[model samples]
Target: MALIAFRRRSPLPPAEAWRRVTDWPRHSAHVPLTRLSTEPPGPTRTGTVVLARTGRGRLGFDDPMEVVRWEPPGPDGTGRCRLVKRGGVVVGWAEIEVRPDGAGSVVSWREEARVRLLPRLFDPPTAWAGRRIFGRVVDTLLAAPPRSAGGPGRPDGPGRGARRRGT
Candidate 1:
């Protein structure tokens, strides 16, 4: 099993940061070759099922997860969420916490995972990769969109897209 923890500070408010981080669909845009689908679709609360499908058709696997705990930010500006991985290929749990800081917010993610058929020797690499991937996801989710239409890049934010040379 591999245990991973990542933490980052965002300039956005706690509520805003929580919303962005918990927006499951937005995760697919940040992660490569993966798609997230939520069942009992709607507000995410306890018991919501999230399935993350990775890789291409026939070559992919599903990481089924269920929201075991869901607590959105309140007046005090602190929130927490926990998901339990229930898939055959992956089994573990992940927790996300958002806390308000001075003029911003801090987000923390912790995950413990065990991959079936994988030797313990691979755990370190797994943890490293998990941190790398999840770190990018956090950065992407926290990045502020262009302030105006004239700002560089897409309104959705900077990413791979058409470039008009010599404009």
Candidate 2:
């Protein structure tokens, strides 16, 4: 399996940073030829299955991951989540952690993944690709504006329903 790990710092608060990183669908925006969806279609929690389909029509693979652990940032401003890949073509695990930083936050992503039928000799290139791809995912997520809680048509503007400090 290829081991991938990296960290990024964001000016957003820990909660906001956590929200951005954990929003499953947003991931596909940065990964080429990929689209993400979640099982049960609600707030993410333990057991939520994230399905990522990559490739062009008929020539693709599904990467399904089950959330084994879910802990959103609380008053202390720290959170962690773990997902286990349960796909025929991809297998491994990924973990994400977010913590408070000085007036901001830091998020870390770690994964041990391997494509089915791939040889161990390819681990280096796999790790390199994973790092580059996921690194861009994280950076773009943090840089984007936070999404609105109620979405379009809501009386309030975007992100209005999002939890605020002391709320």
Candidate 3:
């Protein structure tokens, strides 16, 4: 098993930081060759299944994770979430925590992942890759603007369609 953990501090408040990190689909923007989708598509909560399909068309594998715990920031500005990976290729659990820090916030991500058929000797490399990839994901998520309700890159929004048409 590979254990991965990292923390990032952001200028955004705890609530906003939580929102950015918890928006599952946005994760695809940062993870290469991966697209994320949620079952019962809507707001995520306990029992929501997040499926990440990685690699090209037929050459891919699905990493499905079911949210077992969901806690949004409360009055004290602390939130936590946990997900269990339920997939044939990979298995483990992940946790995300957000805590208030002065006027900003701190986000921590922890995961215990194991890829099937892989030997224990690869644990160090696996953990290193996980940290690099997930660290970038979290950093990018926090830096980007929050997606509007209409969603990013929607043609219906003002000037969006025109921009797409290159007019």
Candidate with best TM-score:
3
On a 0 to 1 TM-score scale, where does candidate 3 land against the true structure? 0.88
Q: Cα lDDT of all candidates, in order?
A: 0.82, 0.83, 0.83
User: Which tens-of-lDDT digit does each residue in 21-71 have in candidate 1?
Assistant: 887877887788988878987779999999899999899899999999999
Q: Supply candidate 1's per-residue lDDT for 43.
A: 78
What digit string (tens of lDDT, one per residue) describes model 2 on residues 1-167?
99999888778899988888888887776789998989989889999999999999999999999999999998899999999999998999999999998999888889999997788999989999998888877777777664658662122212222222210
Instruction: For candidate 3, write residues 13-123 as lDDT tens digits.
Output: 999889878888878877889998899799999999999999998999999999999999999999999999999999999999999988888888899999886988888
What ranges in model 2 sit over 4 Å off?
148-167
Which pairs in model 3 have colliding backbones?
none
Give the range where candidate 2 is weakest over 10 consecutive residues by summed lDDT: 158-167
Ten contiguous residues minimizing lDDT sum, candidate 3 = 158-167
The lDDT, on a scale of 0 to 1, for candidate 1 is 0.82
Q: What is the lDDT of residue 95 in candidate 1?
A: 98
In the order shown, the candidates' Cα RMSDs to the true structure are 7.5, 6.5, 8.0
Q: For model 1, what is the error of residue 10's alpha carbon versus the real structure, in angstroms, after optimal superposition?
A: 0.6
